[model samples]
Target: MQESTYNNMNAARSSKRWDNWEGHRNQINRILHERVLKSSSTDFCKAAIFGAGNCDDIDLNYWLNNVDELWLFDIDLESVQQGIERQNIDTKMIDKLKLFQIDVTGLDKISFFNDINQMLKDSTPIKKVVSYIRKIANNLEVIDDLINHYGSFSFVASSSIHTQLLYPHFNQMLSNTKDKETLMREADYLMSTLVKNYNQLLLNLVKENGTLFIWTDEFELSSDRGNLHLLPQFQREILNSNYTFLSKFIYNFGLKGAVECNKDLLSKFPNFADRLIDKTYDLIYWIWHYDLTKHYLIHCFIIRL
Candidate 1:
């Protein structure tokens, strides 16, 4: 499957190392070990990681030690392949690894089941056309493909990929959508419903008794004036004196707007909250931090189920 233009850009972004790798990665790894993996009731031998883009952002040891067989899924296969090569992953782990190029937006679903490294290198516009033409696509094949070929995974990690599924389509709509009221009302409604359904579908796809991990950006905050710097307690703690990520948005619900961007997501979630899969707060956290780069505030949700 072909990746959207924005996704390709994001994958390219991961090619560069973080400015504060020591501090940023250290905190991230500590959270994976202390909050996520350590709290798991099951040691998943067979696992699948969604949005496993350039695995630079992940703590490799978590998968290497816990999973015997690992499946990596992403919009761009080249990014993940490069991630694996960059990590110098052991040959044994690579042997058990499977990769798939997929887009969960129902817009794009290309299965390079044989080799993820091989992808369609069409222009961004053309790829989007192909993807948009398949807007009603169902990705049940993604999980079924995994099970049929490699068997079921005990765990699924949707690491910051959900919101990204909507980026390209949302942009396309916004650009073409002329009516201001339509942009607010119609766009908001579409985004809210899509976000809710897309998220629930991921949970339903998991095998029985399987654990799922979902970490994503919740909201973005920006001030017209450049004097906003207040952050939540957790952000202050994890990134004490660190300025690596000020306001980087990865996965986002199609809830962007001119104002009330934060409350927009909250207001939308309530409409479909009842339809969501039941989840426990075993390891869940929320943070609103200053985005030094974009000069925005980011609300992030880190949860394990």
Candidate 2:
């Protein structure tokens, strides 16, 4: 099939899978709380979740307990709306949370850069290529306003890592266009933007010696085997670049099949499942290997600023 056709098919499959995965809301929450959040600092007051899917999870509620202000952004409007309607996520809190519909993949547009430039002209020296940081900073302003209006928070959290695999898939799908090189350049641009944005955001939000925790799935590695390289590149950028390193905990054994039938599916099709699972496992392993094992896997970093 042509690349466009393949991408369309893959996009359809991805959408369907996310819809199905939404039902495992509680399990995802449990894992995040048990693994990622329990060890985080108890001094955060404002929190934000980029790529906040159907924000109906227990982990979020835990943050809401301590967080005076919350911000949630996602590319899917329907999912965000559904979260509001079904999850009873406090319209009051929702008002404070500042939900935004943004496609992180679309951060390459010049318009986005322009917006970033305008927003951050007053604060710091933003790199020319790192315009995407503006959106993060803009989002932070919302959180900052909340902090000013309400009070300080003791915790901040995001459940954005669940869709890490989509970055490469989207990049690959787009690369098949006639403008493959252009698409690749755009992917690089987007990654640069995110790294800058994340770095600045970390600098701004994390208190002096404050902690930040990121929760994400692992998706690529040499030993585990996978075809994609997008996330690996991004992960490398994070590690190689400037960021205080912390710790990486591999919940490999903890991630049993989220569903009871998943075991049956894995048992029946071990090879296929192994291929899929290995890609994710290796990605996680690589990040943890390079960062955690190297004593640099600290998703939870402390900033002196």
TM-score of each: 0.61, 0.43
Across residues 1-305, which tens digit of lDDT does each residue of candidate 2 receive?
12233234333433234334442444445534553345345554455565466554334455465456666755555565655565565555655556655544333333443453353454434344243443443432212322242223233344433324224444554453444454344444344444434333433444433334344433323333342344455466665752222111222321211111123223434463254344321111123332211211212211111
Task: Give the C-alpha miss distance for residue 63 in model 2, angstroms.
Answer: 3.7
The prediction achieving the highest TM-score against the true structure is: 1
Model 1 residue 28 lDDT?
Answer: 48
On residues 3-95, what C-alpha lDDT tens digit does candidate 1 reach at each position?
Answer: 656555655562235432334345445655664556555654676777788675565655676667778888778878877877777666667
lDDT per model vs. reference: 0.49, 0.40
Q: After superposition, how far is residue 126 of candidate 1 from its true place, in Å?
A: 23
Can you tell me which runs of candidate 2 are displaced by over 4 Å? Answer: 1-44, 56-62, 75-78, 90-96, 101-109, 112-154, 161-176, 179-182, 189-193, 220-305
Error of 1 at 277 (Å): 19
- True lDDT of residue 88, candidate 1: 72
* TM-score for candidate 1: 0.61
